[model samples]
Target: MSMDPKILAFDVFGTVVDWHGSIAAEAKRLSLPVDPNEFAAAWRNGYKPAMAKVRSGTLPWTKIDDLHRMILDDILKTFNITSLSESQIHELNLVWHRLNPWLDTVEGLTKLKSKFTIVTLSNGNLGLLADMAKNAGLPWDLILSAEVFRHYKPDPETYLGVAEIFNVLPEQVMLVAAHKDDLLSANACGLQTAFIERPLEFGPNFSRQDLHREEFTTYHAKDLMDLAAQLNCK
Candidate 1:
């Protein structure tokens, strides 16, 4: 909070979209013979490890779309699902492109837009984020991704890249995310932080007892609307 950042970089996936609900609905729509909730959880469970490989330089930099597909292939085998045609599988893989925004997202972003510049800093590819923004009506001034930096979140490059994009000091860029580690990484690079409480990011049945603000984040809010209100957005 040292400087008023003109650009607000958002963490997508759980921060902006209901990925759990969206994946579950897609699973149901495909008539996959697995519990939608379990399938959704299983799919998400692979995300961190997938990115870890890239972070550790064990795997080349890849977009979240490819990472999701790799996980999907593994999950399909794990669940003994072999009935899906190639086209069906490919179409299903695009669920990320059609994720649903949280109920307050569009309205909150619209309000915030009047005061500040907004952009995504997601691990998802630009095409993926663009499609999701369009499909979900997210009002972003720009769409940035790991594809641009070739590094995933928690990487200093990705955090600082947002600042570089707007030709501002890192302290002049704020990262808004639901995950602490992400905000911490941004903070380490001299960026301000805002923690968003996305209780059901994983799934509704899962317990998210830790929703309190941490010392690392500059601001914490119940959702985007609350954040906008705190920032005095009109």
Candidate 2:
């Protein structure tokens, strides 16, 4: 891309952590009657539409953690599950906070930290991201969230907000994400883009068929490790 972006803003959900596996594992640990994989998929399936309500201004600014709970409640009902107590539900909702990072995430981020300022630009709330980073050992310089900008991904404000935070031009910031729409939004706002392949983001059984680089992204990486290597991070 450009010589080097001053700030590397990351999309957190699937790019950094194995959300599907993490959620599924939690479900398995709880011995939920539903299939862990399908439960994970069902929970995630509600994410976009939930965010759409906020994007369309139908709902006021809501964090992804709250959004996840709303979806989870519905999913539990849909699956005919009524065994979970209030405490159990609350604990289950915090699964996002306890997500495990990909194997390369900590080391790769450690290397990249030597060269650039790294931050999270996720739909997750600041509190949620902060807790997750601490729990997962993610070395983020800052945590930028939808809660900070009052807008979600694909919104220009969210992308430009990162530039504002670091006091840099849009082109001097790079958004590394597993989703194309996210990268496209960042690119439209003049930020550099890196597409990280997270083939099993949805779940292990489901294969991701799309892995090609799009015109919008500045870099395409197999994972955080590959991106660190490409950026010449020690």
Candidate 3:
């Protein structure tokens, strides 16, 4: 396991921020007809497929904000709710930019930032991530995204792009994420991997089954704070 990675690239959704809880709360606040939890899940479920279209060349290179809007439109129809105006729909879509951070996120990232060059490696667009970091007080040296690379996670270009941006070898960078698929892809690209567990990432109704430590990852942490501790961060 490489303990001395030069750059720590983090996945924002479900790792630094509580996407499920945040989305559900916002949905409840908006008085949407569907169950808030289910709405959040449904919205998120559309993410991969929408991105797949871009990845497969079926769609042009679309930013996450645009993709999210497309998904939200479909979800609205599926939920059979017609109360929202266009402005309201746009504001609701911005919930992703206003997501709440996990309780330990700020403290953990602060600690790690003191020790390493910390940045984001999320599928979230640059503007979205910037707004989230501003809203949540996340301390980051940089906010790198799929938007910058024009490719999403699990794509080697996205992972290797971090290394290229920092002029470091892939092994000198570590991918810290809550998803195994992301870590696996980064590992395949010769980047070190750290898995952060977020069991409630899908909300209270669904428990994640893949939180176990795996051989592919150099570190397995319960949260960002745990990851900070493991890395001997102050």
| TM-score: the better of candidates 1 and 3 | 3
How many clashes show up in model 2? Answer: 0
Each prediction's total of clashing residue pairs, residues at least 3 apart in sequence or on different chains, is: 0, 0, 0
Model 1 agreement with the true structure over 1-234: per-residue lDDT tens digits: 455678899999899899999999999988999999999999999999999999999999888889999999999999999999989888889998999999989998898888999999999999999999999999899999988998988889998998888999888889999888889889899899999999999887998877898988889999999999988899
| lDDT per model vs. reference | 0.91, 0.93, 0.94
Candidate 2: how large is its RMSD? 0.9
Ranking by TM-score: 3, 2, 1
Clashing pairs in 3: none
TM-score per prediction, in order, is 0.97, 0.98, 0.99
Question: Where does candidate 2 clash, by residue pair?
Answer: none
Best prediction by lDDT? 3
Residue pair clashes in candidate 1: none
lDDT winner between candidates 1 and 3: 3
Winning candidate number (TM-score): 3
Q: Candidate 1: where is the Cα deviation over 4 Å?
A: none
Ranking by lDDT: 3, 2, 1
* lDDT minimum window of 10 residues, candidate 1: 1-10
lDDT of 3: 0.94
